[model samples]
Target chain A: MLKNYFKIAIAVLKRRKFFTFISLFGISFTLTILMVLTAFIDKVAGDNYPDKKRDRLLYVNRIEQKGKDNMNSGTLSYYFLSHYTAMMKTPVKVAISSGFSGTNTYVNNKKIAVSYKYTNAEYWDVMDYDFTEGKPFNKQQVDNADRVVIISEDMKKQYFGDAGPVVGKYFEADNVSYRVIGVVKNVPVTSYMFFSDIYMPYTTSKADYKSKSYGGGYMGVLMAANKDDVPKMQAEYENLMKRVPVESKDFQHLYSHANTFFSSYVDTGNEGTSGVFIVVTAISIFVFIFMLLPTLNLVNINITRIMERSSEIGVRKAFGASSKTLVYQFIVENLILTLLGGIIGTILSVIVLAVINNADLIANLQLSINFTVLFIALLVCLVFGFLSGVYPAWRMSKLNVVTALKAQ
Target chain B: MIRLQNIEKVYRTDTIETLALNSVSLDVAKGEFLSIMGPSGCGKSTLLNIMGLLDVPSKGSIKIADKATENLNDKQLAQFRNKTLGFIFQSYHLINDLQVLDNVELPLLYRDTTAKERKMLATEALEKVGLANRVKHFPTQLSGGQRQRVAIARAIVGRPDIILADEPTGNLDSAMGNEIMDILINLNRNEGTTIVMVTHDENMAHKTHRLVRLFDGSQVQ
Candidate 1:
């Protein structure tokens, strides 16, 4: 029976070429845009290299120091990170890294710009960076303020002309000469926490690293022992935050919490508003509003399309079909069209992503329709199909048999 | 095989009420071939539709094959129609999207029949209608008489106990009309299947076992 329905659906589509073209165009165009958008979002926020342990990791990037009238908002200081987060018993490991800063250097007559970060040895253990040559600096190097650095693949190609081994090479950035001890794969700019052209030991930095002040440019990373220990770690961090004494007279209250990467990215430093909730609700609303117009258009087109077959509907009713059966048939027909559009959309997304990747539209960003994106695209197709198909099918099913038969 | 009592069908807008069928009662016994003849504005087609369970009368009860059809729900009515009744319309009402064999197999799709059984039954029905060689042809590819034959093949594909035809031969030339009439006559005589047909031609009416005439929604004879 379904085979017969498919055959009839194909014939109907073939008969009404213009209607089929219009419907397919709308469905495929909308799906292509949706899929490409999802792919970009997934690439930006989804778990990738270095942040692979995101599920079992928490990030503490921002601290709010509030007095009665003065409010200070910035990243946590090295003192606060080393003193409090290092003492937390719930986490398996705690790593600290100063926020990235841009630096300029000249190589052979051309000027080069690079973003660099100073991280301790434990930062390497917390992140899962794939090293192409040599290894990360040890704790002793960080403690001794060793002038050693790890550069990304793209940086190595730019500074060293893609020739010789980058390990044991020397380069200067921000007027500080450093010996390269490792070369790692390039990380996309979207992975902000782990994305930098040059990585150096925190001790080599000229800034104040031992200050007891509560505010500075530093981020602490906490790794849980297992996935199930994430919430326990967060609770432990919260308890620790409550016990922190005011280090400076400038602030009467200190607010800081450990959060997942996404939550930290969207954090507004407000206790009442959950970043996850806000982001989720905002995305849901965006998708809903984005799909509404096309769905309405498809519904209108489907009503006219089904009406053209009113006589067929009447004949089926007169023969033996129940209203439920006719409705099911029409929905199936609509699903076929939408799924075909989904296939076309998927192909179009692949092409678009390739063009963006090849064109270097975004620095170090490579987007692809991975499994998650494909699954979401398929779900969108089904939801779009069902939402667009149900009403018209219902209206067609409610058609009076005699009146439908009389319709032209 | 069929019964209707005081059937009344009214078409009403906000201000006017026009009756399509009024105070009409009918009975068709088992294996009886009956024809209903009337002018264009009469209720011949409306009565046929009522008996076929395609439309409900405003104030009436219907019984088909001894089952109280008026009380049956939509699903039950459809199943009952699937098992016991067949219909052939004047315009052929053949789905242009389906081939001849697939069109004939439509009624069986609602039943619990297997695909193989449906194909065999549809092929057999088409063979009986003398269109066995045109199974792959679409309705538009067939002539008017041939399309009617395919419609007849569809009507009998389920081997229904009663077949209701509304102007089955109205769109065909006399020769093609006679060919369709012969098929119906053969079906009635050989299988003892009851038939209720609506027509405007006296010659076609005389071909049936009995004739009932209607004028302006009322029975004149």
Candidate 2:
């Protein structure tokens, strides 16, 4: 029986080619844009590559260390991380690293700019940087403030023109010379925390390097032994936070949180709700509104189709079909249409993502559809089918049999 | 086996209330071939729609096969229409999208009949209507008389107890009309299928077992 309905639906669609084309165009275009957007968001917010241990990692990107009268709110200083964060017991490793800062200098006598970060030895131990040449600088080199650095493969090629093992070479950065100790894989720019063109030890750059202030241009990345240790470590850190000696006279209050990637991004400490929640809610509402016009247009097309098939519906109803039967048939027809359009949209979105990746629209941008994205696309198709199919089916079902039969 | 008592149908607008049927009572006997005759706007189609359960009367008591129909819900009414009654319209109302065989098989679709069984029954009905060779032909490919035959095949395919035809031959020539009349008469005389048909042709009405006349929403004879 359902096969019969499908057959009739196909025939009807074939009979009305222009209308079917318009409907398919609307559905496919709407879904394509949505899918591409979802893929982009997924790549940025989701865990990808060397940060795979993100689940067990807590980040302290911001800190507010308050004294009696003056509150210092900023990224944690190297002194604060060394004194306070290194003492965290639950973390398997507490890594201190400066945020990537863009630096320009003469490399091979050509003016070049690179994003670089300074870190201690544990930054390498906690991070999984795949080395292509030599190896990471050890504790001795970092402790002794040796002029050594780890450069990305792209940076290595840029400086040495693909020279083999450029580990023993010197590169000029911000007028300071550092010998390349290792070459690592290029990190995608999407990984904001880990993406850097070059890395050096913190001691190499002297800027009040031993200051004990609790605020600066550094962040502490904590790797716990287990995911469950996150909250426990945070609690212990908070408890120890209260006992910290405050010498400042103006700012008195100090507060900070150890947050996961999402929690850190959505820090409720800054807003009434998590920024991630707010962002997700806002995007969902925007997408829904974005889908409204197309969905309504499809619904209007469905209504027209129903009107055109009134005589057929009349004949079916006269033969003892209930309103439920008519509604079911029409909705199934709508589902078939949307499913077809969804397949087309998904294909188009994949092609679009490939184009974006190939064009390097964003540096090292790697966007691909995974199982979750596929599931979302399927969900969109179902919702679209139901939204566009229901009202028209119901309206057609309520039509007067006599009037419908009389309709041409 | 049908009974109607004090059936009245009122069609209303914002400022107008037109009576389409005025307290009409009717009874159709088993194996009876009944024909109804009336001029246009005499409520013939309204009366037939009520009998077919396609529309409800403003005031009426209807009984079909000893079951009261006044309180029958939409589901029950549809079931009754599917299992007990079949309809043939003046325009034939054969779905243009379907083949003749599919058209005949429609009434059986709502039933619990399997696909293979439905095909077999539809084949038999189409053969009876002399459309055996044209089972797969669409309605647009058929002549007016052939479309009417397909409609009749659909009507009788369910083996319904009652067949209500509204001007079954109104669109056909005299010869095609007579041929349809012969099929209805033969079904009534041989199979005891109760048939109530509305027609304007005096010749067709006079050939039925009984003739009913209506004028201005009222029974005149």
Candidate 3:
């Protein structure tokens, strides 16, 4: 029965070459758009932080007002740490880090400038950076730190030779002697922290700069103990905030203080730009519908073919051809066309994705036809085939043989 | 054998009801070669259709091979047709997309016959109709007479007990029509299969063993 269905379906398609081509093209076009967009979205949402235990890591931001205006700010300072360190009832470990915006020029007979981040001893443990040379800043170094910095591989190569061992070596920058404590790998382009080139101990920067509000800098906290304790820790921190003495009720009224943490720091604005995705989805639907239209055209064509064969139907009825048998044959023919179309469409989609990926317009995009997308494409084709074929098959099966044979 | 008692068929329209077969009764013995002849609107094809199980009568009891067909569902009626009847049509109805061999093999496809067996049987039928050399040729590639022969091969491929031909030679020239008639005659004489045909030409009607005539949806003689 299956062979018969396929045989008939192949015959029908061969007979109507134009229609078959149109149907296959439309379906493939739709599937390609859908698959490519889905691959891109998957890349954007979960690309960089695959190994990070993001659920246990929290980034703290202070939402506070300055003067008469309302402001939502992310930068925190050492003032927050001094207040929260004693007040917190939980064992949640916090790390304070500050990134300097200005570029520093290293004299290699020529000026090589790079941006740097100054962080405390906890920064290395929190970020989990694997150093290539030397060691991380020690707690004592952060508490009473002097001229020491960890430079990236790119910075070392620019200021020193490519094979030069920069660690334990001094380089003059910003009119100060800075010793390279370690050389680290270059940060990946996809990462959010792409600008920082050097790391300096936080205490050295604080003492030199005389900034008392270090707690209000960008603070990232890691709860390595367990995730289930987060709600309790957050509640305890909020409760501890109420106990801090306020200078005046009016001062308290002017500042609406709330603390919130992000588990992952993606530029939410960049991440939320799904306009391309929407356009892709809409085009996919349109192509699917366009493909279905051609199938409907095939149905109309089948009706005419069936009418042309009405006498044969009558003769078959006379010779004991069951309506069920007729229905089965028609369905088999439809399934065969659709299955062939599905194969062609899948091939076309792969080619289309490959071409688009090679265009280099979409950043870091990789489109591969995975099992999930293939299954979905085949399923869609089958459903479309079944739906398109049902009505015509039923109509052909119900044909009244005597009247059909007798008609002029 | 076939029996029909008080059969009536009325076709209803929005504003009119036309009777195609009315209070008709007939019997046909096994291995009989009978032809039904009538003018236009005379229900000759309608009677043939009822005998073929292609259409049901408005009021009648039909018995074919001692089985009552009045209560048979569409599926059972189709089974009955496949197992007990064969058909030849004026237009050939050879399924133009298929080769002559595949078209001939269609009837057996509905049966549980395996591919190898169906191919053998269809080849034998085509051979009988002198079309063995043309098995791979499509219907469109054949002449009108050759196409009819392919249709005949398809009908007999299942070895049905009855053969129903409606205007079987209407689309052919006289020479081709006579050739088809000769084939039908030889099959009837040699195989002892029951044959019922409907025709408008008097000369063709006279060639059959018995001729039944109808007018105004009723038998006149």
Instruction: Tell me the alpha-carbon RMSD of every candidate.
Output: 3.3, 3.2, 6.0
For model 2, give the TM-score of chain B.
Answer: 0.99
- lDDT tens digits by residue: candidate 2, B93-167: 988888888889999999999999999999999888888999889999999999999999999999999999999
Using lDDT as the yardstick, the better of models 2 and 3 is: 2
| Best-matching candidate per DockQ | 1
DockQ for candidate 3, please give it: 0.61
Model 3: CA > 4 A from native: A48-51, A58-221, A226-321, A365-367, A402-408
C-alpha lDDT of residue A208 in model 3:
45
lDDT of 1 at A83: 90
Candidate DockQ values, in order, are 0.70, 0.64, 0.61
Query: Model 3 chain A — which ten-residue stretch has the worst lDDT?
Result: A253-262
Q: Candidate 1, which segments miss by more than 4 Å at Cα?
A: A21-41, A51-57, A83-94, A208-213, A223-251, A269-272, A291-298, A368-373, A376-380, A383-388, B3-5, B27-33, B60-63, B66-68, B189-193
Q: Per-residue alpha-carbon lDDT of model 1 for B1-221, expressed as tens digits?
A: 89888999998999999998989988999999999998997988989988988988899899888888767888998888888999999999999988999999999999999999999999999998999999999999999999999999999999999999999989888999999999999999999999999987788889999999999999888
Order of candidate numbers by lDDT, starting with the best: 1, 2, 3
Clashing pairs in 1: none
Which order, best to worst by TM-score? 2, 1, 3
Task: Please report how far candidate 2 places residue A108 from its true position, in Å.
Answer: 6.6
lDDT score, candidate 1, position A7 = 97
- The residue-by-residue lDDT of candidate 2 on A60-86, one tens digit each, is 787775555555666778988778876
